[model samples]
Target: MSTMGRAGQAPMVVVDGVRKAFHGVTVLDGISFEVAAGDVVAFIGSSGSGKTTLLRCIDLLEPIDAGRIVVAGEAMGWHQQPDGRWVRDSERELARKRQHLSMVAQGFHLFSHMTALENVMEGPLTVKRLPLPRARQLAQELLAKVGLADKAHARPSKLSGGQQQRVAIARALAMGPEVMLFDEPTSALDPELAGEVLATMRQLAAEGHTMLVVTHELAFAREVADVVLMFHEGRIVEQGPPQEIFTRPAHEATRRFLARVTGGVPQPTGSS
Candidate 1:
């Protein structure tokens, strides 16, 4: 319900006191944040610290045990009834709500049997019921947007890791999501391959896509994020502008994390 944003517009995504658990182990604890339209918010933390889980909760790929996630003003996972009771939404309803957001995972989960263009066209054609010509056109445009126009006829196995990831990005974009969720999108790629995927993500940020990215790419976080959140033990311990979080982290956990990842606390990119 907190719509306050730097630009005075309602936020695109709101996660309020969200908590999630898996097999009796808490994964997300009291997580809350607001992603303003066009904001690129990066989440960083050690493995098992719950960064990816938070993205899953936001995408409704994993149900939160408590709290609410709202995207584009509609509650996800559950809806309130007239009698004041909260009820879980049906699978059909959840599918409809999922259209408001799209997620790209670490692994490029492309369909091996489909070409990049066919894979990108799958969502709009099947889920949105777009006409064949319209879906094809949209997929073509998105593939081009992600710099994969030439790879349209290539299958997943035929593409490089970076190219496959770019195709995955194009497929996500074909859905016309209001918010984009990235869960360690480049972690599975080699440095060279990761760079290409990162470049595509950077382009998305520049194009004003509201994004929530969970990543270990510290430089990307510092360079591209409007806000950087440091998660520890399933909680966000530090969050601020990238300069503050990267250069002047106030939390001990944050400092330790930076030291472990980058040898020591790194200064801002252009600092003397």
Candidate 2:
């Protein structure tokens, strides 16, 4: 399967001929797409359709069996050498590359012992080498941005699932990433909590963050995504603007998937 991605003013991510297999089971086969700067690309498909695995591959958490992923003009996990051969990039180099793209997984994954402010501060302090006072200030600002300034002193154990997820987002933003990747970030949350997380993500999209989200929320995808990719059997079967993809899907599998997710009632396309 192949897809020629829509053109953007600046292509922030380029994924080409990517393939991945797990213990002899293929999850992604020749996946290709481009995410432009400040664009939100939503990946939607049924369970086991390889949505999350694709995100993991882009983040370099899963080694691809073939092909390449490039973000912000830097190839992930591999580097082209002087002799024009691709070599596995050093661990240190890969770490540097990851700093450009932050990921939020399904779980909040905050440090249980640390307060929300401290959890957000840890990244800046440990990774970016900011001093305690500076990191504290920065953390507070990020929490405020996520509408969690008042919850700064609250521990993850004390916060609701929604608030903890927001804190996790703040922590990711603390690293000053050029792109953000979300792997079913709200899947573990209840409906109310998911709404809060979606609100946070909506705000991020409005603020011009480049995002690649794997989500089951068709509503959010229709409302916030500039582009939506419909995956099936380890390949993106259809992709286009939200309106075209949702209201006028080109593939039979996509129509069936939307029918299942939206309960035969798809919301009107364009803007939240």
| TM-score, predicted candidate 1 vs. hidden true structure | 0.95
Least well predicted 10-residue stretch by lDDT in candidate 1: 263-272
Tens-place lDDT digits, model 1, residues 47-80: 9999988888888888899988889999999999
lDDT of 1 at 231: 97
RMSD of each: 1.8, 2.0
Clashing pairs in 2: none
The local distance difference test score of each candidate is 0.90, 0.90
The TM-score values for the models, in the order shown, are: 0.95, 0.94
Write the residue-wise lDDT of candidate 2 on 1-272 in tens digits: 22334454547899989999999999998898888788899999999888999998888888899998889989898988899998997878877888989999999899999999999999899988998999999999999999999999998999999999999999999999999999899999999999999999999999999999999998888889988999998999999888889888899999999998888886565554
Query: What is the clash count for each candidate, in the order shown?
Result: 0, 0
> Pick by TM-score: which candidate is best?
1
